[model samples]
Target: MKEKKEKWYKRLEMPDAFVIIFSIVLLAAVLSYLIPAGTFVREEVDGVTRVIPGSYTYVESNPANVLDLFVSIQKGMIDTANIIFLILIVGGIVKIIEYTGAIDAGINVLIQKTKGRYMVLITLVALTFGILASMGLVANAVIAFVPIGIALARNLKLDAIIGVSMIYLGYYAGMVAGIFDPVVLVFAQTIAELPLFSGMTLRVFIFIGMILSVIIFTNRYAKKVKNDPSKSILGNRPFNDDEGITNIEPPKFTVLHGINLLIFVGYLGFFIWGAFTRSWGINELVGVFLMMGFTVGFVSRISPNKFVKIFIEGARGITYGALVVGLARAVVIILENSQILDTIVNATLVPLQAMPTYIGGLMLFVFNLLFNFLVTSGTGQAAIVMPLMVPITDVIGITRQTGVLAFILGDGITNIVAPTSGVLMAVLAVGGVKWTDWLKFVWPILLSWIVIGTLALLYALVTGYGPY
Candidate 1:
């Protein structure tokens, strides 16, 4: 009956992220009653909570009732409040920039400026946006850039799908590559009890490689489509003029647009500086974007009331992702409060203790890949998985840094193909590409990531990459 129901459910569309996460929270609560209750000693390290090994002990089973399950979602939101608000501020900034016509205007100038150098345009845009995404500042925010990319591709006689891939793939790669992505990197590292941003050197190289692969893939597809239109993934599916491409003259490059572009680009520079030199956290990151939103709105002469409306709408649009992050937290809360997380870890790890180190690390990488399809939010993935895996890796002699690496790699690679990934589907819809076409096009890249990542994990294990 359970298998039949799951198959029937699979035939239906995925539920809301919140619903899926909440269900997992309930399932975890149920497991607490079924599994023996246990915990590890914990202590503060660098102002973060960490489980102390060799402290595992059986505890009284404290099962949650239905009421406790219902309230854990609220607790989830409260715990993830910092990240949830950070997402809102960033969303508002992107929305106001869209309202200002700056995003379109800047892309218009880019198309005009880079005309006839289609490869240059693809490489430049992909790498630039990829870098921004790597910093965790501008990944989902690229939704607004999708139409602009399609417009540029159509005008250049390239496939609309290539245009969308340019943004989505680059961001996805950077996200998984995890160079300077504060949200995932900080969450995973802190949970694993590694120094913040440890193992940056290896990640930077991997980041460059992934960015380059996207550039190559996008450029190749773009060139093929440029040479033959019928071969385009978007064949015969007519795109509307307002979808961004038209016979009308592209918007003129004006002084106001130029200043707005400078401000946008200049702010990125300022952000990078602050991030590296000043050790900026969530608060500083949010403040910078808040200022960017107001500055762009004021400079473009958007009325304060209209600006307020846009900001609210922007925040509202991203509320789903923000809330899902918190609701996902409830899963962790349920497992922790039940006092059985360490038992799950130890029971699983003790059996694998004798395995070769590289294989053990690869197992983690593979586990993260499978786990990511279910929990798509990077923050949430870290919140639940990292704590369980951290001690297991220590017991098995795999470094915490390697564990975090596997988690991110596994998490990122699957998002490209997972139907459960809201962002992937959302990006495809914005680009007018079908998920079927995307899957066919993306399989090679995904396979390459798996191979490369497994090798990287083995290397990290052999080298004992650490700040442990």
Candidate 2:
């Protein structure tokens, strides 16, 4: 008997993360040849680069060649090495903690308490991550939570996608809300010359809307998968369920487990404090993670050799996620080198400037969403885009606060779906989720966020959404 052929659309499959990213890098390089290059005048302010508003001028096109593509990859890798290594180290640390059965035992205790009320657990976890993210949780910092999320998924008999959504969505959603995201909020507001975290009443509503959307979406999917295991996006089981928490009986929470959990919690608290107060970067955080790992290893009574072995194993498991960060960064390298990024920004903004007040406000959100695909760094994009947005907002008869909101919401919401977002890719990689699978599961939530963000931007434009 002959089998029927699948439809052409059905036959198509998205490539893995590396291919998708590299293809984009290639496209960016090619566009350099076709598009005119331009740049904005930039000056060093307090040791940081800031683009001058109205400084855009066409420069000679410097298209990236094939050789440049390879060079950019190397450059990208070097540029993001700190983030790359931090992921590996955090992986090792998490593995060490996991080997002690501390995560299992602690999660087991919580599982029992919330046995039938998993949505409550989901809501609490989502809110915790979201709130922390708003308070200034960095993207790479979210990596440390991925493994724990997967473990939670296994315990809940849900798919890895659901587990990742609970944490990843929560964090990114909060970031888009930008209620108090120090990196994006403070930088954009400062650049726009608005009061720091000013207009937060609107942002608080964004924060709540985003977090609640995450909870509701995550719960619905969790229920669907729970009722029918076959409906899982990752298929009947998971991508890598070798240490299946559901299959094995959870170990009892013991004194050693309690100590390990306490140490872990304490480390996170200290790290958050240091991150906000001391302005800890990746290197500083790595040192602290190492210290936490060794302390937990010693307290868990893991022998030195055993600890080394487990740490290596954990790091090895996360190599896929770690390496992809550089690959994603290569896209930015190509765009910056080609000098077309500013040209694209200039071209996009000109049309918006001609738009009506409310339309321009909504378009600002749309532009940021598209622009984020090329420049994913929050502060970096702010340095490049926010300067231009301030003048545009004034011309469009909207508050600068409105422009800042558009910038943050556009940049933050698209992180969920943007191919150029290294953090998003890294999180999915760490979660043992395929890029395609995540896209399929996340599109609806992404749409909901887009709607919420667009409406908010429109409201801001209409209300002159600002204290400034």
Candidate 3:
């Protein structure tokens, strides 16, 4: 047989997540040498450190050496250890739940009840994800739901993209709205000195716009795939069978399955309560998840030894994603160590400074859109950008609340596309989708989000959204 030549496009393959992130780190290191280092005078404000405007000064160049590049990776891992472990533990818990066959059974029942009306399922699931995220569901915590999303989609004859999108698309949708998002909205608003949740009316409208956009986009693609399997982005590509969700064997919905699912639902409700009332952090969240896993395992009658083995297997399966989060953090670490992060911020903002308030607000959205690739954490990005935005918004004739709106709108929508987002990478990893494949599937909806997000920022700016 003669060998066939590969297509040029096929040959121009994007590297895996690790390679892509590391390359960014390398680029950041190189930029450190080129972009002069700078700093801003920061002081404690309202119990948090914030950069003072007009305090930015050119600092001695502190280029990252080869040693710093390697060390930053270690530091990044340590810094994000809490998040990485939380993901691992959640993976294990999800694994334990899957072992109970409860999720599969529940998915089968859902599929049967829905009569394969995939759009309904997509809307409900995605909306649920979005709503919960709006109510302070941490982004990485979305991984806990990916298995159910993927399994539900697969069982319904939809592709993995539909499943993952149902979860993350809705998540980012709600996240972008920042209705009550503690990490994104709270941090941004507090730093911007806006009344917490004061501008929610506009945010609610933004949420509706975004979630509807997600549903319409997801439903369109799903309808095409359901009508023609060849339309799937994962066409002809086999899912990893080891994930267990890909090749679902529908199980009977037993009484135990019902009990387990109820427990799972209850756990989610409690999680939201804890987040809202108790202000539970990641460690607390992890503790509750562990409790849920064990409770499910006990109810399912899985023996201790088997539970241990399954937990390990689940954690092992998710190791790739957990590490990717830390790897992404390394890029930020490199930028910070090089002292060019502030320089990058200053350079980006200088252009926006000269624009009108409305235009500057839009430009701020664009800036955060690009900057999110460097600082993927919502709270982290707010910490860096919100302080600076407060002063700029003041001078630019926009309310601090308007700045917060722009910051979040720009921060969130691209999560589905940002390779530097550990939570996003982890979600993709869990869903068994490649970055390239996800990018191709997501670009259309992402464009829709961009339009919707742009309009939301303009509305905020025009309305002078604020209590300040």
Model 2 compared with the native: what TM-score? 0.94
Candidate 3, position 118, lDDT:
77
Cα miss at 139, model 1 (Å)?
9.8
Residue range with the least summed lDDT across 10 consecutive positions in model 2: 1-10
lDDT of 2 by residue, 1-468 (tens): 123344655777768877877888888888989999999999988787988987889998899988998999899889888878887888789889988888988888888988757788888888988987877775457876887788788777777898789889988777788777767788888888888978988988888888888999899988888888778777755646364335678789899999998898888778777877888767887888899999998887889999999999888877876777888888888888889889999888877878888888888989999898888888988998888898888888899988999999888888887766778877876787777788989998989888888788878877878763
Q: Is candidate 1 or candidate 2 better by TM-score?
A: 2
Q: What would you estimate as the lDDT of candidate 2?
A: 0.83
lDDT of 3 by residue, 127-215 (tens): 99889778777555677678888778878877888888899889888888878876678778777767778788888888898899889
Q: Note the clash tally of each candidate.
A: 0, 0, 0
> What's the TM for model 3?
0.91
Q: Give the winner by lDDT.
A: 2
Per-residue error for 331 in candidate 2, Å, reads 0.7
Q: What is the per-residue lDDT of model 1 for residues 108-156, given as tens digits with 9 covering 90 to 100?
A: 7676777669899888878877887887766555654565576667666
Clashing pairs in 1: none
Name the regions of candidate 1 deviating beyond 4 angstroms: 1-19, 46-48, 116-119, 129-209, 216-250, 367-447, 458-468
Candidate 3 residue 127 Cα shift, in angstroms, is 1.8
lDDT for each of the candidates? 0.73, 0.83, 0.81
Which regions of candidate 3 deviate over 4 angstroms? 1-10, 137-140, 242-249, 463-468
